[model samples]
Target: MQPILSLDGVAKSYGGVKALTSGALDLYCGQVTALLGENGAGKSTLVKIITGIVHADGGTITLDGKPVVIESAEHARSLGISAIFQEPVVFDALTVAENIFITGRPLKGRSVDWPTMMRRSREILAELDPSIDPAMVLGRLSVAQRHLVQIARALSNDARIVIMDEPTAALSHREAEELFAITRRLRDEGRAILFISHKFEEVFALCDRYAVFRDGAGVGQGTLQGMSSERLITLMVGRPVDQVFPKQVVAIGEEVLRVEALGRCLEYENVSFDVRRGEILGVYGLIGAGRSEVMHALFGTAPAETGRIVLNGETVSIRSAQQAIAHGIGLVPEDRQRQGAHLRLAIGDNITLPSLGRTTRGGFLSARREREQAAPLAEQLGVKMSGLRQRVEDLSGGNQQKVVIAKWLATAPRVLILDEPTKGIDVGAKAQVHRLMGELAAKGVAIIMVSSELPEVLGMADRIMVMRRGLVQGIVPRSEATPERIVKMATDA
Candidate 1:
């Protein structure tokens, strides 16, 4: 079969560092190709090269068997290439139809036709899903609805090739299924799809072909039809990963945290759980299951309307995040980019932000003290960077996650709440995080892990607390927990 798009020896470099050593791929019409790679394996760089966010240093990019230069994102879109990012871009204040037509509205006789815009938008939206109203404001729509709107906008552009990057990262199982259906329809309609995701199940379920990247180079490409899952992993990591989810059995100690009758209107109610020292309590739930909400309240990011929080058998009032930190609690929020890291700061500065007081000399911070504290944490976390002076934002997603974890770990918190700690990270990074959790648990830190991935919950948690619609359904021990059981608990009313 002929490729709709092909990139040969596409290369990119940054400050003498190679970002894409040999970026290569082939996207065929009527097929969904899974782009597999660890974070920093050049997948994102290749995406940028294709979309013209950045120009390639050297390569042959061919569209329709003819060499071409993608001058810009606008040029790529004009040439039937469109990308849907993990975070859907939409104008919140604008109507759904307005957002769809923002790129290029249909022409009317001498002026922008608002009515025709809305009408055409509704037609395009119906092709994906009809639940969204074209005239309705986009801000009121759900994330899933916003995704559909983005897809509708792409189709409106007459896009022949679509790139979906981690589309299911934040979606529930049902929502993911809906997206899969839409993706398959697009494939059947002869649109070439490039799907980038870290999930094996999603790739197997939705993609027809597979291509892997390792250390900024294309390592493998083939049909996924008879590919073993293990072989896929080996191709991605460039080596055998002995343990994907490394969990350790640790000695349980005194109770570290206890929550009873925790309540927040329209979020969660009557939530109760206990975390003992050296134990990981995994919280598993659907998107709106209030897992993050409960953790937010516990971490003091959002105080609960009513609840009893006990720390070390003593009742403590945590009115804010400062108080939570002061009381030996730390939270690595779900959205690390916006909520966790200070992007503009250096890696060392971010890691030492919470421990500023400890790094103070007289009345001001000591640079030496800060570096001393940050260096060990960064090294311990296996943060790959030139130095601590590098901007945290410049690091890849996995490295950024490491910095976030290192930041909180610098504080030496007795209780840690991690919300989707490994979301969007590579397999190696995920395994490293799991190993870190095991180490922390062994050291008697009461950990509360809120994750959407069932495998993570089952592999790491000593006990799983399943929540459904703002309530705890059941708490099952690791021995008794399975994907089916946890899913049932998460979905059942």
Candidate 2:
């Protein structure tokens, strides 16, 4: 069967660097195609080209057996192409109906037809999710609901080729299931869909076909039937990933930090745990379980209303992040893009931002000192970059995460907190991050890892702390921890 949309030898370059050397993809009506790749594999570039965010330097795009050039985002929309990002782009101040028709509203004799617009919005939303109110303010809706509104917009535009770019990245498991339902509905309606994700489970569960990109080129594409994840990994990185979680054995030493009875109103309560030298204490829980909230409190970003922190056997009050850093603590937050890295800053600058005191002479910043400090950390973390002068925004997701870790490492904190450290990265990058955690633990840096992936926590953590509904269920040692036991502890009352 012929594909509804097909691209041959699509390529894009930037200032002498090729972002996409040879991109290829096919989206068929009534099917979901999984775009699989490691970071920097040109998937983003290909998506941009298709969506008209960037024009390809070399390639042929065919729609319904005819060649075409997608000139801009508006043009792409007009051509029945629409993309829904992880974070739905909608105006918070606008009503759901207003946002649905923001691009083009119904008009009766020059003036806007409010009743017609509202009716159309309700009709579109009813198809996706009838519970959503067309008259409700967009900001008042949950993340999942906002995504539904975005889909409604796509439907309103009569989009036939829809691209979902990590749509479940910010969603809960239940919400993701709901999205999968919506996706199937779209496919059944004879619309072609492209699903871009880092999750193998999600890909295998929802996609009917597969396409893999590596090193800026499309290396493989085939049906998902009879395809093992191992084969897919091999195709993505050009080699077998023997171990995605390379956890190394390290000696557990004296306790370095402890929290007792930590509590925050409506967030978390009575959370208590301790991390020792050369120990990896993994915190596991479902979404909204308060795992991150406790970490935020410990890091002083969100101080607990009721609790006492003991650092090296001494009680201390950490009311701010600076205080936490001064107390020899560092936290790599879950949302790296918004909370961890300075996107516009140079790599060297971001690395040394937390330790500017050491990189300054006579209250003045020293670029040489900053470079001297950042270079080794970047190299140690194996951050792939042209130079220290390169902006953090230009690096891949994996490299950007490494930069965040390196930034915290520069502080030389006795205790390190990593929240979803490997989230959204591919198998290759996940392994690297795990390896780094092992190395850090071996060097006697007390580590606390907060992760949602069960295998990752079980593989790397020396001890696991389970949280449920803002409360600690239990803390199980690695030897005693099993998937069933942990899941029960997290979900069971």
Candidate 3:
């Protein structure tokens, strides 16, 4: 069967650096192709080329068995191509109907046909999700509903080739399932879909074919049938990942942090756990299970309404972040882009932000002292960058995560709370993070890691704490923990 869209030897270069050396892909009608790659592996470049955001320097793009040069976004849209990003790019101030027809609205005799526009929006939204009202304001809808509106817009434009880039990154499990259902519907409707994601589970569940890219070149492509995740990882990184977890056994020491009967109204309650020196305590739970809420409470970002926090065998009251920091506690939040790091700030500045007191002299901040303090942390975390002056926004997802970790490490905290530390990073980055966690544990830093991935929790934690609906289900040692047991404990009513 011939592909509806195909690329051969696609190449792009910025100045002297090559972004894509020999990119290639094929999108067939009635199928979802998974675009798998590590961060900065030319996946974004390929998407931009296809969407006409940037023209490829070298390559042959074929559509309908004929070579084509997509000149602009308008031209790509005209050719039935549309892209839905992780964050829906729509005006929240506009109504659902207005957003659906923002680019082109119905007009009757030079006057905008409001009734016709509303009717068409209703028809499109009804096909995707009948529960969504066309007259509702876009801002009032949930993130998942906004995504449905984006899909409605694509259908309104008669898009035949749709690209979904990390569409489920910000969604809950149920929301992701809903998106998957819509994806299958689009495929059944004879649309060629390109799905780009870091999640292997989603790839296996929703995609029929796979394409792997590494170092700006296509390394592998074939049907997803009979393909193991290990094989796919090897293809993406160009080597066998013998130890994806790489958890190191460190000498467990005395208890460093303890919580007794921690509770917060409408969030979490009666959460109690203790982390020993040089121990990794993995917190596992489903979404809204209050795993992150407990972490936030411990970090004093949101103080627990009822509980006792014991640090080094001494009960302490931590009602603010400053008090938590003073008590030698640190937290790496789940949403790194929003809460963990300063995106627009320089890497050195962000790292030193938590430890500004040490970087100041004579009641003034010193750049020399700041670099002296942050440079070593960045290097220790293996943060790849042009220079210390470079902004954190310019780094890849993996490197940005490292920067966030570095920022917290600078605080010299005895207890570190990591909320979804490897949430959106690639396999290589995940291994690096696991290794760092091992190193930190070896240094006798008590760590509490909140993760949604079962394998990660099992691999990295010396002990696992399971939570369900703002309550502690059970705590199991690593030696006795199994996937089935953990899942049962987390999901059981």
TM-score of each: 0.92, 0.92, 0.97
lDDT of each: 0.91, 0.93, 0.93
**Residue-wise lDDT of candidate 1 within 148-251, one digit each (tens)?**
88898889889999999998887878999999999999999999999999888899999999999999989989799999767988888766655777789799
Model 2, global lDDT: 0.93
In model 3, where do residues sit more than 4 Å from their true spots?
none
Clashes by residue pair, model 3: none
lDDT of the structure predicted as candidate 3: 0.93
What is the per-residue lDDT of model 2 for residues 329-374, given as tens digits with 9 covering 90 to 100?
Answer: 9999999989999999999999999999999999999999998999
Pairs of colliding residues, candidate 1? none
The TM-score, computed over Cα atoms with residue i paired to residue i, of candidate 3 is 0.97
Please, what's the RMSD in Å of model 1?
2.4
The TM-score that candidate 2 achieves is 0.92
